[model samples]
Target: MSARLARARRLGALLLLAGTVQATPVHASADQPEFTVTGAPADRRDVITWGASADRMSNAVADRGYRLVVHTSVAGRDLRVRLSNAFGDRPVTFDSVYAGIQKAGAELVHGSNRPLTFDGARSVTVPAGGAVLTDPLPGRIPAATDLVVSIHSPDAAGPATGHWMAMQTSYATQGDHTAEEGADQWTEVLGSWFYLDAVTVRPLAGTGAVVALGDSITDGWQSSSDLNRRWPDYLARRLHAADADVQGVANEGISGNKILADGGGQSALKRLQRDVLSQSGVRTVFFFEGVNDIKAHTGVTAQDLIAGYRQVVERVHAAGKCVVGATVGPYKGWSEWDAAGEQVRQEVNAFIRDSGEFDAVTDLDHILRSPYDPERMLPALDSGDHLHPNDKGMQAMADAVDLNSLDCDSRSRTG
Candidate 1:
């Protein structure tokens, strides 16, 4: 073969390996004088360093304080917190809010606790179906740091919004103890995060984030508690160590979440804007969902699920961002498993693998499925249940993601 033809073949192979089609490049005129636009650099914007999916609260706790522990994904200054009343039926008042570094258990690092305000006011009342963001706290928070967020609701009632399976242990108190940095008053332990949904930080220019949108598996259902072993957590660590511009990760997974309907939480279609697009500095959306919809046997065909996926992709792309779709993993031994559901799962995975509708694809089904059965999860990776993955399986899923796929230029998509 000619040298030119060989080079073309090699390029085609590389693009195939990357799972993306090549776009034609635009060239500038060589005769034009290159005048540089010089001025003060633009201010850096806030990027989400940590987040949890919000779901309807099981019960309401009145006049209570919570000291939540969350792990940061990227380091930066001017930290901020977002509190949600998304599922509340009435107005909820959060009179006190504080942020600090966790030393151990409910104890905070000495002198690290700081008060937070909303629009210069110490207290804010979030209306039903609304949310509030605190003014930036002036300080640098390092990546992978254990940050503590304390909140006290004076007269909170009605439905509460929170993530039930946090996979981390946070503390709670009977009365207003958000001001205290000690663990003495925080005697009650909880496995969920309340009110607070996202934490943002102002990072340097070029820093970006990815949001993982999915169901119980993505929510770290079977993963160890307090270990930060969720697949997204692992992906965050990988991004921090790599040369990729996407260094932050926001996990938007709620247990029993569906792609088309509202059950455990608002459907992925309904919450896409508030949960994914509204996040700061999110360059790409990692879409890994649909198992619940399939297993629920809701008469949803592969076409229905594909339509939902297309809608999500279109919305994200319209926002000038890329999406990486993950194939649904196997769950043949799970209680809800049925041959008809499995058939739908197979059809959906086939589309995700071959359809090029997504900017990129991650074959999670190939990674998590048992080599022997091909329809069941690997026993070693399964956390006793056939559906959710354990820590090892979570790490495997994170490893399957190509780090380079997350770094998409927003201008390229828009232009």
Candidate 2:
């Protein structure tokens, strides 16, 4: 997809007069130098309030429509939706796309559903390993609201891409139901999010964002399903309450992801650019990975993980953003837990705390560890699996984070 199309082009005055199309909102890409949308005012810049990392997908049905439901983290207007074909083997064409507020179940709020366009056209084609951002809708999306993005692809197949573990209930149906506000025909229930990857909004100046990069725990494994109880979700709520400047939160965690190697998804090093740096208004990246690599018994040492962490920190610093390194949480009861892996985890956590390499440090290990036995996770917090945390534990991890470290104030001091 061309930038003019992938990144929604400005709606000219003539088009506005003709009422042929609405304005699409464009966000800064990794290659793009600014966070501000082209031709947009300086004060109202787009920031990523919600995002899900795109991963390899199966079951790409032809002539199918999906109504993906996602929760936003910040209050903002002129909302934009991003659709990805990142892992596709060929081009995919979307003839219709719509954005609206969820009323109940699969139904959308009356009169809130509106069609989205790509480059002043109703349809757009996304090439292999590319994405498209729809034009902005002229309205406000409140914080902690469920936003529905409906999309229809007439011929979509072959190695599609999306976040497989949405932890929310989305809907699917046959044919082009993108513009429908009623839930009558949307009968399929989907556990994973398809096609749609991100949602950005124009907010007041100085409002920033933080992206949490991690594994299954951060992916909301044991946290209650469909409740938005992920640690990052809790942190987003905190950001909105105490800090006005840094209010956006993007959870980029993929289940089974490793920091130094690729398995469930691209390794942290390989995906940093797209998942973290490319996101607009990202003042910091809260690094919370490496559990998979260490617990998998893959011959991954503490030094190997540290090298990867250093590379990530250098790249984030180069992009002029903060990296908040987190200590790996305890996983004593899990089958993969072993003395050698425990030793490696301790060494890595020590470096994360005392090395002074990261811009900020969030001692998650200190927070989640048991008082009686420091090497194991606290039983009250453990979700019975001992590796992942329950709702209470997830909230505890979010509370452990110093929200001040997530803003640019720390980055300013470090830089």
Candidate 3:
């Protein structure tokens, strides 16, 4: 059998492993992560990269039968799975990966006998330099399902595949004082060079998290890797401190996504369902996009861009979820940015600030614009490109968010 088929067959054996077939569809304890990967530098179709890791940390935990961290507090129900090879030269293989519940802080806890499968099979092999989707392994998880997924090499191979989602420096061992000496950084390459996409604990009962979607600015470009200082990461920390029931932030931002057209990725319209709507227990979405669209490739008009935002808002609201809009930051120095684009950006920002269509809105333009010269870019936030926000800038962006508008305490009416 082909590696992909072998992986598929392995998944078929999940039921034979010993465990009681408990009545399923019970709530998962927390939210699962929303992970996806695609190529960058706008318009490269054949060469693919994934959101993965270079070190085998996640692989070790999954292989040694360590429980996924999210299970400690996930809502049980139909859970979502996203396996990727957003950056790989060969087919990526996954062995037996399972998700379930365990006691809080249990590192080695393996919950239930349930395993992840794709298309009714056991193992799965993502195409060389491509991405794949897994079928939902339903009913196996309950409230607080502790996930333990084991990935073995079809042959010997590395774990992560794409650009590292870095904010601050990360250590190989969680809670260990040892530094992640000589670890790879994102700017060194464009894609995940073997990294963990993300892990989401299912929402407990009725709670989930909102994934802030966008580009490198959202990804925290130039932020200290593993510092957990990305705006989204910071927002997560703030939410946790507030004793809010938020599970965690699943950042799907790719570093160059535009709202209306495919540049760094399939346009917002193309990825909305997969990146935003499909998140488990998602009750709200904060839309922070369009800067690249208005200033970069698309050169879309202010009215057209506003219309695009409107479409996104409509779609989210149709799903019974709240939406928040973020104004685009100044990009006076972006390679493609010019006076004309700045004018359009100004128009769009005015609309975002004045528009009541969003459940809530944030003035990122106001926060990121240069105080010295309103038309000029903020030197601190500029990534030298005068386009993407630097670390402090991303943090500022994160700080700018009005968390209250997310409405975490409110219940979602799901279809």
TM-score of candidate 1 versus the correct structure, residues matched by position: 0.88
Off by over 4 Å in 3: 1-81, 84-93, 98-198, 203-206, 408-415
Instruction: Please give the lDDT score at residue 166 for candidate 3.
Output: 41
1-415, model 1: which lDDT tens digit per residue?
2542443343332222221111111111231111111111112366788988777886678899999999999888988888888778888899999999999999999999999988788898887766777878999999999999999998998889898888899999989888888999999999999998888887654567899999988898988888989999999999988745677799999999999988978789877766776667788899999999999988999999999999899878877788999999999989999999999999999999999999999999999999999999999889888999999999999999999888765444553
By lDDT rank, best first, the candidates go 1, 2, 3
Clashes of 2: 3
**Candidate 2, lDDT over the whole model:** 0.81
List lDDT for all candidates, in order. Answer: 0.83, 0.81, 0.52
lDDT of candidate model 3 versus the reference: 0.52
Lowest lDDT block of 10, candidate 3: 41-50
Please tell me which model should have the higher TM-score, number 1 or number 2: 2
Find the candidate with the highest lDDT and give its number. 1
Model 2 / residue 325 / CA error / Å: 0.5
